[model samples]
Target: MTKQLASSAPDLPHLDLPHMGQVDDPWGGVGEGRLFTGAWVQARGGVIEVKEPATGRVLTLVGRAEAADVRAAAQAARVAQVDWAARAPTARAEVVEEAARVMGGMADTVVRWLMREAGSAGPKAQVEHQHALGFLRHAAAMGQEPQGHILASVPPRRSVAERVPLGVVGVIAPFNFPLVLALRAVAPALAAGNAVVLKPDPRTPVSGGFLIAQAFAAAGLPPGLLHVLPGGADVGQALCADPDIAMITFTGSTGAGRAVGELAGRHLKKVQLELGGKNALVILDDADIDLAARNAAWGAWLHQGQICMSTGRILVHHSLHDDLVTRLAAKARALPVGDPLDGVAIGPLIDPGQVARVDAIVQASVAAGARLVAGGTHDGRCYAPTVLAGVTPGMPAFDEEIFGPVAVVTAFADDDQAVDLANRGQYGLAAGVIGANVDRAVRLGARLRTGHLHINDQTVVAEPQAPFGGMGASGNGSRISGPANWDEFTTWRWTTVQPTAPAYPY
Candidate 1:
């Protein structure tokens, strides 16, 4: 912990964090910490003040990095990657496993920071921490798995193929699920024998990037192998343009993902992108209205609907459309909305800009003939959980990705219409179907063109061992998590040997 300071600006409120025993001043030392080249150094680009969205309070200052800083970090990673890749797989796995243990021990501290910095509720923070830990452990175990394959060759010859790391991987993580998203790429990259340069969202530098660096350092990972640079798009651009960065793994908006993909393509660097989604949740006439409402509420309102796979569109059978909307509106109104530290279901948006964006979308939808069932209001940075009915296919409310606590409902005539609506979107990230007939729901799910489909479940679901990604504009062809990640972070090389010299045809 470092010395705490008060906000000098009168408009900025005082910091108020949850009380966790013996974990005083979670924001302390944040401004002074920049993990580079195996050491915590001060940022030369100055500092940025992080504010808690729940109260508009200045939480702490974080060191900001610029292009020079990014270049330095990349150079350091390049230098360290050789030794990191040279180590035995078992030895690397042990270090990652130890890091997971250390992170689990600091769960309380990490959760508090997540709530304060990222505006994540207590439950959401817990989920992020648990997922991060699980992924870290899984990655450690994967380190010892087979990395190559043996293939039959011509007579008296042998052939083999092995997966190799892509030197230095640059990971740009989003603010929504900062901790888990960053670690999802970092853990696998490390396990596959690649060094990493992480650029966490500037808005959540402390909880998103700094904490992971601390845990890995404490777990005795060789210094310089991992670097956390907390900065904005300029830093990210620098990272992508760096000649030494062999690959880029990014999680953010589709627009931003396209820019990254383009830059990486121009540079001939491997890139993996997990972008936005306008996911849908369908309710059949035979479904239990209460269960459907509950699932819809949880899927649409969790983390204020910031998740990429949040159910943004709800398609219901015309027979049950009105009933489902009524029940869902009630569920939305009943949810607690307030400060994240207090364990509320709906917390503040990441910033005023987001609140304005969501509010504007809701207002526009209403003007465009969508009926507001409940919510559709904002107080400070907090937007109420909103439900809108009569949403049509062409409206922005139905067509766009509203990254907020907003759910749009549209009625469909039959299963064909429902599946058609689900598959109509350009984004094919995820979708959910709820029905009494499980077989029917599964059949419909098969027809929908989505990367992931849930029968009687919400779209917002992920496990560390599941192959998670999207199709079309939602993401690139690459997938992350589980064994699929190994393919993305590594390259394949084929080797061959002969027992005796053979004459060349030439």
Candidate 2:
């Protein structure tokens, strides 16, 4: 059992909650207070009330979905997908493009919901909203592009390969990046002409799931093309098992990803997973210690370090280890930790449970010989930005993905040792190398076994057109962003035609 630590720091003063009328009803006045399945319909299950992490204030009440609701949503998607696919790709692109425009218009409301529901700080919320818009527009553009190839076959036959939409895509998104994660998959899947059954984390129904449906609907997408069902594990299991759902794209913990992959495998359905990571930041001796410290602080403590690509481990060169640790610790201590709406540098964890989990990890790491360098205290939902040194390979702080505002540092003797130390963990999600020599840093980054790497930058970075996903335990074979996403949401069919009779071997 995880034990909670008594907070040694004082709580930050609370900010006044926004007016209720300002928050848009995600249901859009369809069902009285029910889940959105084409139109608002009452779920067979009960309701879930989301609470703000900073103050524990009631954010909103949303309907909780069950297996019956999942089936209904899946059926609706199955029916709508055929017509959606029949439409011109350009027409579909127009709808998605309109949705992006709508999202841009509603940026303020969306950012507020993200901060309240997902504990995102002001800047983080804004970035997530912007990224969501960019992703939507990118998807719209891809939808209009040519999607098939023609090739010469034997003799008089012509062979062609065309990309076709998978019937229904079941999207299960995480709470950390509620808006962006959902849109990252949803936009691409919709652009490919597949209907979507989105099951967002129950914790972020309005920000993560329903807001997406509202955007598309406002953009003039036909009813039933996207159904947002917010619920728990039961809902997710049902979505995975539904016969009508042809594919599953999930973003969450590695354990949950494994379970989802196994379930999808049993059904022989296509699945794309973007899971967790214990990312690392390597500081070479040639790096500027102050610059490295600032970048490391940003990557390790941003959004309370809830990001999947957060730098959980810092491997510094032996020569620079002491100086880097001192500078990084100072940076961590100075970060403002408070309410998300208050424009604080760091914010609360998603809930008390998350607070306890993070504290427990920190306590255990300290017990295992890791030295606490600075800020290992919590106040209410907020955990102070923390830095730990003397972390070793086998310690939990070094080996595990501590998803909090805490980072552990260890020293490496040389370049080869740094690479080995970075790759020793099971995760291969993201990494960073900080050095004055860009070429040397790039060479070292190439040797690291991570899916994405940065030189003289932080691990937590993403672009609209970058191929984003992980290898090994961090994710399965499928990737999410850039041109790579097209293959995951679509299937290729080879067609051959012979105008005239050709000699047949048979």
Candidate 3:
């Protein structure tokens, strides 16, 4: 909706995004052909148009939401939560199972839609759907397992603690993982018998909301149990500040997370946040250059480095600095780029604005005397995967979270220096360590500040068994792992019974 200056192409890497199809031209952020909020209603003066990064193809335009509408939606969700929670656990589980089956039927169409709407590559978009399905199935299974309790013996009495659902839960999700993150909140909330008020990013609502609504309907959830409130900050603020909402779970910037936390604190409601990360990828002296290069590339470019756990900063041993940069640069340059639908390695950014922001960050880093080693050109919203070397600790590329394809590489003379440098950031989300010596890798991995550390590998996604959350700025004390997820959604009420009356203590 706001007009900024158009920039000339910057000199960096030669990244090419494949031409997938005839994407619409953008106006404000509403794509010309797509049927969105603007299409359904009269054109409001201010609209932010989302464009494909690679070809300047207009993807969608998001109109600003009215605050009044958001309040009404939140109020509606609060009214519906009680009845939804009263449903039997098995009944809830059956709905979750049915959601999975419904999602499975529409998998292909959903993947393609995500590719167009979110600019996600085929493989990655497919994985989002898979994650959605997994969350649904896992939640259903969890529901079947009855709430557990511990027994205590005193005099001749019995005691037990049972889990019960929290009331209306507000879920504010991010754009990077539109569908997957939505399911993450929905599955657990529903399984624990809580109703959810979902505020998805307007950027990719159709792709995310359509699938979720379909799944909920197929699962036989109550009509008003889950409400989709798609809009921007106004909507989010309303939901967070509302006293009726029992809890708020958010995934986004630290600033936004703080705001949500403040609002929840004021209401004395629970808040779970997964915030920013300037995650580090530490390459030890013993790491295999070839494998490390491959892993580092994946860490930097997957989802265009939009992931919360993305490896934005690279800490390498000084001894192998040149070798590491050369390998990483070569691998990055070699990756095929173009259309997301064609299954290219890198797709366009969610919108042109993101591409511009990422490009500016890379340029500013270079202007500050950091060397651009490889990949940094922009065609519309499409930016080539870039590598930066000769970076020092104070540089923005090293100090900040660059949620883009660019990775900053800083050389460390020894293991101690590498550890020190990696721990310099405010974030403690996730990190990756590369080494040939198993013992050294294991030992050094323990020293990293991140909550999730991977040894000689890059795949560190959420697993049903493993806990996922950060230590410091990355999150509050919350994790979506095993039974912990179930615990977060429910509260424990201790109940005591007496077979025979106990004597009073004198």
Candidate 4:
């Protein structure tokens, strides 16, 4: 069992909440209560109160937007994209790079917001900041890449193929890892000369939306180029259905992703969906016990395991299952869980409802005859790091994605059984294989049907410079990192020139 998270972080170094000056001018004199919908207009939707998950303290307020607001935001982006796209690609790149520089100065403010609003520990907040900046710079680099090719053609004719912006792009980012998720698409789309209408989850509007807007605006990005609307499902649907918005890029749950994809398909617009995962971590017989245990603990408990790529299942060879389980459970118990501001390795869930849902899954799995190897309880939203042994396919812990700090362990007979166990689920987001034999581990990873496979690594790894995405329920076969951006945010245009008349038209 875990103790209730306290309001103060007495054990950690000195901490200060955001005072009036720290957050006073984040919106350039606009009150913290309202969202900046491109034109500095107020939101038509009702007020949403931002609360600290551990203490239930109201941190700030933001608007919950309605569908009309989304349409207006999209229209504004449509109008601005013309001028924005008309600029030189290098100039666009400079603006994005400059935004990263300006945002670097606000690291303290960003960390505080992440800690209070998103329940991120210090290390995770730092990682988020660095990754957000990496995405921005990577987008800038992409803008400098050659977008067109001179094609070989028949005599007396020249052919060229170029990729151009898809005009206005709509982005919906989830509350978890909002900064990285929102920027990964938004930066690339903007760098490609497409204006973006971004819908941040209402649960984390400030850290997810306003911070990015402020940085870009401060960097001299043209007004109306981007609109940040913090809203719920209706607003997301409206953004997808807007006629001017050419594409919709969304990051969230699989159910929500399906809805977004369906709506965009109905409208004949492109959509990129990054959704849920029940990632697996496989421990082979030849692997180091301590290292495998460490990887499992990190993959399962980081950010309270709310991440989509969090390891949900651990498949170990029967020879090492018992010993590996014991070590991993001990490591899970040693980690502290509390308020994010307290500088603990693990932190609280977003709210009480999430706590109930996670606990209920753990309980159901136990009732289904799975052994509770470590933790099976919570105090408020601070659920203890949990481990379950003897999990099988029919149990809730095995089938459902328990997006909490819970690890489920299952034993396999051999390499073939390990492959079958890893590939048993619908989610194909990420998986990891740990073994002393590097060649054998890589060969095994190649057999698993996941988008991101790590050899001798954990499931929680991500790189801004690599192509990151998934298949099956995890995504729609679309990717959103590095060069993948060029495909997701732009379309092809073919141009041809003929000095002499041909057989056609004459």
Compose the digit string of candidate 2's lDDT tens values, residues 386-408: 99999998888888888899978
Candidate 1 accuracy as lDDT: 0.85
Per-model TM values vs. the true structure: 0.93, 0.93, 0.86, 0.93
Per-residue error for 324 in candidate 2, Å, reads 1.6
Q: Poorest 10 consecutive residues of model 4 by lDDT?
A: 12-21
lDDT of 1 by residue, 1-506 (tens): 01111111112122222110112154343334333446767778877777788987766766678889878888888888999899888889999999999999877778777877898887788889999999999999887689999997886788999998899999999999999999999998998899999998988877788788878888999988888887888988988899989999999999999999998889999999999999989999999988998898888988999999999899999999889889988888888888775557788999999988898888888989999999998889989999999999878788889899998899999999998898877899999999999999999999988899999999999988888899999999789999887789899999889988889898
**Could you tell me how far off, in angstroms, the CA of residue 124 lies in candidate 3 after the best superposition?**
1.0
Model 1 ranges with Cα > 4 A deviation:
1-35, 500-506
> How far off is residue 168 in model 3, in Å?
0.9
Candidate 4 lDDT over residue span 1-506, tens digit each? 21223233322121121211122223233233455655455566766777778777665667677888878778888899999999999999999999999878777777667877888877887789988999999998987798989999986789999989999999999988979999998899999999998888888887888889888988889988888888778888898899999999999899989989999999999999999999999999999988999999889988899999999899999999999889988887888888776667787899898999999999999999999989888988899999999999989999988889999999999999999999987899999999999999999999999999999998998878888889899999999988888889999999999987678875
CA lDDT of each prediction against the hidden true structure: 0.85, 0.85, 0.73, 0.85
lDDT accuracy of residue 400 in candidate 4: 86
**Alpha carbon deviation, residue 270, candidate 4 (Å):** 0.2
Model 3 ranges with Cα > 4 A deviation = 1-65, 153-156, 498-506
